[model samples]
Target: MEQERDFTELSMMSKTRWNDNELRYFQHALSQLLPYVNPEGLTILHEINKEMQNRD
Candidate 1:
């Protein structure tokens, strides 16, 4: 789906300008999407986790 692709692309970005709330929302959305997403989605989740860690 286009939505999945869009999220995948956004997740791959090296510099995201999302604020704390936005990051939290994205993280939650990605988590909910895991069951229906592809293997690469796991990688995206990992990247997002790393971003969260880097911020903290």
Candidate 2:
């Protein structure tokens, strides 16, 4: 299986013009907070993806 790259580090490299600076910062912050958002960590999204396709 392939491993996912870390998002916090990834978003840190993104550059934005002045208008989008806050969005860039928010994305970076959200990336770091993802691990703590759910007790299942990242597995929640994977488990739901297949079911989502069947729903819509």
lDDT of each: 0.67, 0.43
List the pairs of residues colliding in candidate 1: none
How would you encode candidate 1's per-residue C-alpha lDDT over 1-56 as one tens digit per residue? 22233444555566355456656777898799888878877776777778788899
Supply the TM-score for candidate 1.
Answer: 0.61
Model 1 lowest lDDT segment of ten: 1-10
Candidate 2: misplaced stretches above 4 Å? 1-18, 38-56
CA lDDT of 46 in candidate 1?
A: 78
Worst 10 residues of 2 by lDDT: 14-23
Model 2, 5-52: lDDT tens per residue?
454553345322212333344445545778676764344333334334
Model 1 ranges off by over 4 Å: 1-12, 15-17
- Which candidate number maximizes TM-score? 1
